[model samples]
Target: MRLILRNDLRKLMFALLLLAASFGHAGATPPPKEDQIILALIQRVEARTDLVFVRNGSDHNATEAAKHLRSKYKYFKVELIDAEDFIERCGSRSELTRKPYQVRTAGGAVRDAGDFLREELRALRAN
Candidate 1:
């Protein structure tokens, strides 16, 4: 009888530990607002296949642009304060060539990448 009770007590303790762990995970903090905005911007870039991203005098597809932007975001994350900062630092220009990035629409209209992203950001905020 004592052995049976000991085993039951051990099981109860294990159950309690699992419950506590689950509660701890539930209370974990989420990413900052800036990070959320930056991720949204990246997603926007990835979804827009109609626009050509111009970096260093070459054009890239949306997938390539999104990948490049993600790498730049990771590299410059520590220095970034907000979504605008991220656009300016990571999405705006080529770090090596010092040339501003551009976006060409399907109709051959060109605009600065920074301006495009800023407009997207504003649209996101509006919604």
Candidate 2:
């Protein structure tokens, strides 16, 4: 009986080890940076935008995200524009877009949803 119990315990331990190994890859949590959040939001545009950033100024959260993503993912094209530049291009506006991105949802605007966030980064991030 003792031998049987020991075997059962070993099996349980082995199962636990396998479970832990599977979960190990998920152990590393990403940092809570603004750029990371922006990237996460822009996740919707992944198929279209390898890296499309619509932020104002030389320094901003999107820039920071681009820098970080550059370190991690090499196969991306980072594009940056002034917040105003995006609003001019798109008429509709979200709080993120001080200019406006609130135009009729169609065609090129729909195609460039990732570019829609340029104003969002400005309102949300510094520089």
Candidate 3:
């Protein structure tokens, strides 16, 4: 009877180990490379105080632009998988306001948010 009990314990331990191993792979997969690039671009865009973005037919500073994008992202109804989706649905324009956001760079150059982000992504992909 003791030997049988020991055998049952070993089987239980082995089952537990298998269960743990299965759970390890169940966690979310890492975000794609483009997502990382997009996040970095968002951070950089957020940090720049000089850049201006037009939203809702009004001008917003860099911080406000970042905040707006983050808000859009959070309240977004759909699952955002990549930077393209975020840029299209949130960063590029206001769905409610119907205004496309434009970014004014530090050098006094103005660009559409989508174009600017695509440019940034291109540069990053090049490296």
Q: Pick the candidate with the highest TM-score.
A: 1
- The lowest-lDDT stretch of 10 consecutive residues in candidate 1 is 22-31
Candidate 2's TM-score? 0.27
Segments in model 2 whose C-alpha atoms lie over 4 Å from true places? 30-127
Best by lDDT: 1
The TM-scores of all predictions, comma-separated, are 0.75, 0.27, 0.62
Q: By lDDT, is 1 or 3 better?
A: 1
- Cα RMSD, each candidate: 11.5, 14.3, 8.9
Candidate 1's displacement at residue 105, Å, is 0.6
- TM-score for candidate 3, residues paired by index: 0.62
Task: Give per-residue CA lDDT, model 2, range 6-108, as digits (tens).
Answer: 9999999999999998875243333336336445434422332333333332222334434433432222112223333323322222234353222113242
lDDT of each residue in 29-108, candidate 3, tens digit only: 32667557666767767877877887766888878877777677666524565676667777777787767788876777
Model 3 per-residue lDDT at 38: 60
Model 3 CA lDDT for position 113: 85
Clashes of each: 0, 10, 0
Clashing pairs in 3: none
**Clashing residue pairs in candidate 2 (N, C-alpha, C atoms within 3 angstroms):** 54-118, 92-100, 92-101, 92-102, 92-103, 93-100, 93-101, 93-102, 96-119, 96-120
Cα error, residue 83 of model 2, in Å, equals 29
TM-score of candidate 1 versus the correct structure, residues matched by position: 0.75
- Candidate 3 regions off by >4 Å? 1-35, 105-109
Candidates in descending TM-score order = 1, 3, 2
